[model samples]
Target: MIDNTIFNDKKVAFHTLGCKLNFAETSAIGKQLTDEGFAKVKTGEQADICIINTCSVTDTADHKCRQAINRLNRQHPDAIMIVTGCYAQLKPEEVAAIDGVDLVLGANEKFNVLEYIQKLDGTEKSEIHRSEIKRVREFKPSCSRDDRTRYFLKVQDGCDYFCTYCTIPYARGRSRNATIPETVAMAMQAVEAGAKEIVLSGVNIGDFGKSTGESFFDLVKALDTIPADVRFRISSIEPNLLTDEIITYISTSHRFMPHFHIPLQSGTNEVLQLMKRKYNRELFAHKVELIKSLLPHAFIGVDVIVGVRGETDELFEQSCRFIDSLDISQLHVFTYSERAGTKMLDIEYTVSLNERKRRSNVLHSLSEKKTKAFYQNQVGNTYPVLWESRHNGEFMVGFSSNYVKVERQYDKKLVNTIQIVTLGEWNDDKSALIGV
Candidate 1:
């Protein structure tokens, strides 16, 4: 039995790193703690417990996790520190050994944190509760509101595809999700909670319903029937799983926005094969073309990684040319970083760190041109904008229905409300369309 009195009047602090899924999970954890009589520590205030959710997408991410753990420890010396998430799941002992850490929870154990907190034996030796990734099977659902007007609902978790340079399958385990009805119920609850926009977050949302034997299309259909003003945006989904039928359905959805985020790791089939990606370059291009044909004004974002194990100089140039050929609104570029025990190390060719930065810069410049062009094409067009509660200096910000950022002079009345506005000239960096 756990004692609820121990948690009463205590305070907690949270620091989350990487991805919307992580943010949603952190929020779920926060809610659990707060419901147990713990109050969230405000800015610059110390707490009785600190939870740091770490990411291990790259080596740089691991370093950042360590830095965050240290910074939090120094700031709250008396707090019982806990570490969890992908980093902790991938390297439980390493996280447990971190200075001032009292507990480390793995993917399976994180959801059971309340029980573990009831068993803390102090800092003499940090407690580790980790399980192998292959044995992880339960599907936990999460929904969270960011500092903006958007709510991120975790529809799925984990990955089955063991892409050659990737450790997601190892860190996150197999692809799985809650049933379509359960997921739709979560969305309805978020809508009831005043969510104007909701982003479906997952490691592979398109692969949802693997455990329950339901297709992603079924889930999308159920979410669309929601009788509310809330908008839905799909996060980064695999090109192979993002079928033509799904795109067609979203194009016609009243609740779903005209926005799509797809991951195309490489532009050439050669590099793609080395990475063990499911879809070829031809299939990716066809998907992009299909989206453009159906939703002419859709905001399409693509993810690309530069300088992987087998990407040659000629191949990088070819990839750049292929990316340039796409009608994407923006590019989410990732610079390649070597990870331990991955299949990419066996590949003969490797791009230097400096070379990777150069390749990334090339793609970034191309993306800037693509985005500026996409924004310019929509200038003077009127669209409904959902103003975010978070302020931007003396200005307030909002995103159009099509995912274009628009700004206006600060207005307290505009927070969390949808208003029709005309997009105008680019601001200083042209990052967002000016609201007129």
Candidate 2:
């Protein structure tokens, strides 16, 4: 029998290894553990229990998860180690087979972690509680308090669209979400907890309210009415679901920042069709144009995946040229990595590792140029920037309303507060705008 008294003075730490959605869920789990009498600590701190929220979007992610487990087990051999999240849901048996893992929970099972722990009886083998993905139909609202300056509020969960180079639908289940009223209440709660910014995040947030006869636009409209002094930012949305009305509404909203992160996996129409993406290159370009026309100072970030199957050199060139033509601020380039059971695995004409790295480097250089040009444009303009807690040497860093990073001398009074400052020349690194 396990000693129940051990829980009275146990410390627990959590480490999340995925998107903002995963971080939000991990924070919710941490809050639950805290409510249940477990003292929360940093990931590297000594703890009686350690929780790893894993991600399996790429093979490298899986390898990192394994390395973290091995490292944690070596450092804390007597700790009760638990692993959960997408990697745990998709491959419970594989994760359980890893030495030093005490329990493995799936997408639906992670929420019931306390119940599962109560049933454990000092078992030597790793306990697995994964269920079929189809059975995960409930929507659990979560928000990350990992940072006092911002919180990632999970307004939606799961995905109905199974893009060819994706395993999120299989890992997180179908599209579902809470009602607009419920989500607004959650946002209010976050504001009460001292959140300066709340990022609306999810697997496929554009598909929000599909199960409740509502729409993503409706959710945002409701949230805009919240009487909190917090700025709201959408994490990412599908081009097809990012309607013109939503863009126009946000353009006029006081609380919503002038920033949008849209994923355009490929700029070539043929590659997009191969990836089963919903929108074409033309439609994506039109969306960018619309956002630029409405919110002239908007910060637009594009997500591009390089080196996917069927992406020939010619197609990659076409993609690079098309991205170069866009009036966006920055690019988040992801080198495509094959995942097990994804539709892309069966597709022919895969790009080699060396070629993938080459394409990724080209995009990275382009991203730097685009970001630098965007920063240069804001050199003379004054904007309201919300300062974060972290500082670099004597400088404090923050992001403007349009997501421009600004730095000033460190001041404790400026933390978590929005200040209006005129932008000056870029620093030596040119990574951030400095206050004049």
Candidate 3:
């Protein structure tokens, strides 16, 4: 039997590499460790245990994970190393083969991490406890307390829509979520903890009510009723699932911010069909139009994947043109990468790496132009900016309700406070709106 004295006065340091959902999970893991009599190591401080929560969305993410493991191995070789999250869930054997991983856990196993760690003996071989993704059905609700200004509440988990170029469903399992009452309680807890904003994150948040009988709209509506000054934002939702009711409710709700991030993988119907995306170009365009019509000052962001399988030059041009015609504030362009066991790998044609980068550049340039125009349009408007704790040399930055980046002279009292400020002319060189 392992001795429990090993954990006495232990310190743990955590590093996460991925999306907001990953951050929420990592924060939850940190809370678990802290509650178990472990101290959280401050920045630049060494610890007895190191946890690396990893991502596996693309080949780049996997490469970065390996590099991180090697770097951490050098920094804390003797520290009890734990690797978990999407990358570990999908490839536990591969992660266990890393140089310093002592324990590797999957989606279902991560929450039970303390139990698994107590049984480990600091051997060369990694003790992996990853269950199959198909078997992970229960939703273990998590909320990030890493920052006092904002909270990432994971109201939903997993995805059922196995997109052709995606491995999320395989890494995170099927769609599941907490009941409405449970979600409201979580939000209230965050508010009680002094959070100014709450960002809802999930693998497929629009499919929230699949396992539970609660809809996304119902959950948000209940959240709006919570007696807190915190605002709400949806990280990203599928175009098909962003119903008109949700849009209308957000427009009327005082607590819901005027921002929507909807994923429109491709404007070409053929490419979208190959990606197994439910919404077509027309549907996506209609959704954007509806948001613009209802909330004129709303910030509409689109997520687009360029150079997917079978994306010829003609189709790419069509996509560019389609995006250019939309009234979006910005675009998140992702260059497609081949993932093993994904439907895209078995597809007939493949876009070259050079072609993918070229397409990505084109979309990035377009996004810049759209963002500049959006900022310019808001020059004379007044917005309530939620200032964060981050600061440059002389200026502190914040984001408005519609996701506009605003900057002002550094002031200690302004951090974490929402102040109504009028936007002045854009400073093109800095790419920020001047706050008056």
Candidate 4:
């Protein structure tokens, strides 16, 4: 049996990889440990425990996990190294094979890391316990810590869609959503704790209602009942699942922000079909048009992949043209990186590094233009902004309802409070809004 006494007043460090969801979960875990008397320490410092939250989205991500583990071992050779998250969930054996990893906890067991560590405290052999993710029931609650205005509330978990290029379905299992009442309770708790805005996050937020028979629209309506002070933002959603009813509801809701991020892997029908995406370019464009027609000043973000297999120069140009024509506020450009177990790895088309970089730069340049134009249009408009902590020489910053970044003079009283501000000048150098 392991000893729990070793954890008293112990210091621990956490290293997280991948998505905002992972960051929020890590913060939650840190808070739990802190409440249990564990002190948070900086990475590379001497600590009793080191937790590495791994990601498996790309092969590079796996390499980064190994590197972090090695570096931590070098810094504190005697510390207990714990590996968790997507990479560890999918490949616990790989994580366990590392010389210094004392424990490996999979998806279902990650939340119980402290308990497992207590049990393993003086044990000679490390343990690897990973339950299959498909059997998990409870949704984990995650939110950003203090010192930030916007908190990420993960109301849903897992993905049922097995896209050819995605290993998330395997790592996260089927879709599981938190109960409507539980979600609202947590959201209210966050608001009471000084979170001015909450971003509803998950693996596939569009698939939130599959398990509960309630819809994503229902979640929005429930959140609409929240007192008028706090704003709610939706994270990424699939174009196919973003329905007209949801759009209409958001258009009429006061609490819901007019910012939407829809993933469009490819703009060409053939490329989208090869990628196993559910919707075609026409459907994606129609959604954009519908959102624009309803909320003209809404900030719309699009996700695009540059170097997927079977994407020729002509197809890439077509994708670029299609995005260029959209009324989107910005673009999130992701260069396709093949993962080991994904079906896309077996495909034949090869894109040169130069080509990938070239395509990515093209989209990024267009994104800058689009974002600047959007910000320019917001000049003279009034918006409710949730002021965040001061950064970059201590200038206070926040995000407007349309997702525009606004910067102003620091005020201790304004932190984490949503207040109406008139958009004044555009700081072209900083790519931010100057509010008055």
Candidate 5:
């Protein structure tokens, strides 16, 4: 281990890309460096170390990772540049070939970064430490607070579902997680750090119990026993795994908020089969219907991919119709891009890039309309809102229990505090409701 004194006063800057899970892992890395006596780099100050956590969800994501690496290297010319996460794991050689990267750590080696840093001797080429992702079995628990009051807790890591259109299982490894007690402990730590809301994030959170003998339901029940005033929200879960029992439990629980994020990917069964997804459109609709029936005011966010190799024009139109029929609160639309070394290439059909963009825009408009309706329905109803530390223009913003974005005039006292406020009409742009 490196001596604490040697690391003292060493400032480190972190750049995290992709999911909330990545951010939580970056926070964990920051805490590790802090414990070794490193300070975060302040603005206008050069860092002794620059760590970039990369993503490979899309080709665009990979390009952004490279851009971030180049940008950070330019920003900190002399810093020890470390690159880790999905992009690093999937393309270690490519990442190492980048001009100024000092070290590349894969999924298994990312958390052991301190050991690698101690031996960093400015070698001519970037040092790479990557294990085959399939061999990765250790689950490193992590949690991170956003600028706001919500803290994202990574209850699970990796994925086993290798949907043909996705590279997540390859980049992240098989689905695994820490024990329920350990996850509950991490959540308690976040609460102690003054977290009012904690979100459970992961690659396949519904597949959480694979490593341990416990179930996701068991984990939730244990979390509910915390007896804190904090609320919990589950990140995107597989529709097949989001059972009726779990929905019923959350609908009645005071600790769990009325919010759900489910990935539908494609709404057409033929496209879903081509994508090798576990469930079909009927199952997806059932999950949505169940959530709405149990919790009418819940905020239901759905993930959809606009184009894939097998999605034909008819399939896409069918997808749009099915998605439009759903009573979801919003849609997180992602335009598809081909990735290397995936089963998706076996399929022949392809959506044009222009068509992909048009489809994404169509879904975005639908999302806005649904979100507006959801927000409009909340007007005149008082809900507990956890105000954040930041402000947007003249208004301070907060999210209601059901994830309604509410804005009120900036008040210092409201920061990091919970208050019940009735939602007012939307602003001129319809971005958010004015709260009182």
Candidate 6:
């Protein structure tokens, strides 16, 4: 029988792993618990329930999930353990097999966890329930209201493209998008709930319009129509989906931030072909150049994989040169990690760990230099920063129309407000922009 007495005044802790979408969902789930009279507690403390939102992007993710469960079991052995998210969706059997896990809810059924737990308490037995994502209607809500300043609105989900090196297509099933009216309503709701900025996120944001007759452009147009005091930004888009028209539209929209993060897995055409990326280096360069031409101070972040199967020193150098030759503001370098059931895992001639580390370091060093240079260029420019809560001893801060981190002295009033601040010289070797 479900034990309603256990959660009468109990506390809950959530540990989230993965992308912005996962964090948004976690916040939503936490809100649900809080609304039901359960108290939200910090991690590492003893609690009545522990929810772990997992990722399956890389093999390291799997290892970390297992390690986290083991640690949680040691700390709070008696607490109910719940596992959900991509890892849970992909490998429910493996997760349910873990000794301390009390429940495993897959992607489609995870949102209804409270009811499941209620029933579980009545039965006193662990439960496993996962519905295939393909047959579902994207059950979760589209808006996020937990954050005071920024909200991640999931405008799209799942992916149809089966990139040779990706497992998202299998884990998430197929491409799906929220209707234009529904997405705009959520954006407006977030704005009403004190959100100063909205970030549109998804698996493949560029393919947002394929399922519906609406395009990303249409979504942006509708969002722009919302008379909100908040700005908007996109998470990541494929080179092919990031068309010139979209770039031009963002350039003119007052609410759209001048930032774009496009994933360029590899710079060399041969490596890109092997990775099954749709666009080559030349087309990727054009997209960056077009964005820059439209908005000079725009922050163009590129996602590059350092070491994939069959990567040579020459190929690595080519990748580095391509990035060096771009007008991008920064780089998000990822060392390729093999994922189970992905085509790249079965590819012959894998690079050694040391080689991968070396390439990763090289790209990281270059990224630092590029980032510092970008900050240096903004020295005299004044931008609007949306200040966040305090970090270590300093106040957590955000960037302007273009994404640049600027830190200032602590101010409680600026927590969720956008203020105009001038960028000063680099403060430390950390390359953080000091605000004046």
Task: Give the least accurate 10-residue stretch of model 1, judged by summed lDDT.
Answer: 425-434
If scored against the real structure, what TM-score would every candidate get? 0.98, 0.97, 0.97, 0.94, 0.98, 0.93
Which regions of candidate 5 fall more than 4 Å away from where they truly are? none
Q: Model 3, 40: alpha-carbon shift in Å?
A: 1.4
The residue pairs found clashing in candidate 2 are none
lDDT of 4 by residue, 1-436 (tens): 3344566779998888888888888988888788777888864458888999989887778899999989888877888999999999888888898988999998888888878887785665668989887787667877775346678899889988788788898888889887888889989988888777889999999888888888888898999897747888999999999998999889988889999999998879988988889889999989999999999999999988888888999999998898889999999998888777788877798788789889999999999999989998999999988888766765778888898899888888887778899998876576688999
Which tens-of-lDDT digit does each residue in 1-436 have in candidate 2? 4434546667887788979889999988888777777888665678888899999888888899999988888888888889999999988999999999999999998987777777777879999988899988999999886554888899999999999998989999999999999999999999998888899999999999898999999998998888878899998999999999999999999999999999998889999999998889999999999999998889999999999999999999999999999999999999899988888888889899999999999999999999989888989899889999988669888999999999889998999999998999997677798985
lDDT of 1 by residue, 80-128 (tens): 9999999999988999889999999999988778789889876479999
Better of 1 and 4 by TM-score: 1
Clashing pairs in 3: none
Q: Name model 6 segments beyond 4 Å from true.
A: 1-7, 42-45, 121-126, 137-139, 145-148, 391-396
- Cα lDDT computed for each candidate against the true fold: 0.92, 0.90, 0.89, 0.86, 0.92, 0.83
Summarize candidate 5's per-residue lDDT along 1-436 as a digit string, tens digits. 4667878899999999999999999999999999999999999999999999999999999999999999999999999999999999999999999989999999999998888999888677899999999899999999999867789999999888888888888889999999998999999999999998999999999988989998999999999989688999999999999989999999999889999999998999998898888999999889889998999999999999998988888888999999989999999999999988889898888889999999999999999989888888888988899899888668888988999998889998888888989989997677889888
* TM-score quality measure for candidate 3: 0.97
Once model 3 is optimally superposed onto the true structure by TM-score, how far is the C-alpha of residue 297 displaced, in angstroms? 1.3
lDDT of 6 by residue, 65-96 (tens): 88887777777787889999999988888988
lDDT (tens digit, per residue) of candidate 3 on 1-436: 4354656689888889999899998888878777777898877777888889999999899999989988987887678889998999989999999888999999999987788888887567889998988888889888995443678999889988889899999999999998988888988888888889999999899888788877888888888888878999998999889999899889898899999999998989989999988889999999999999999989999999998888989999999999999999999998899888988877888889898999999999999999889888999999999998878768888889998999888898998899999999865565789898
Off by over 4 Å in 3: 1-6, 146-148
Name the 10 consecutive residues with the lowest summed lDDT in model 6. 139-148
Better of 1 and 6 by TM-score: 1
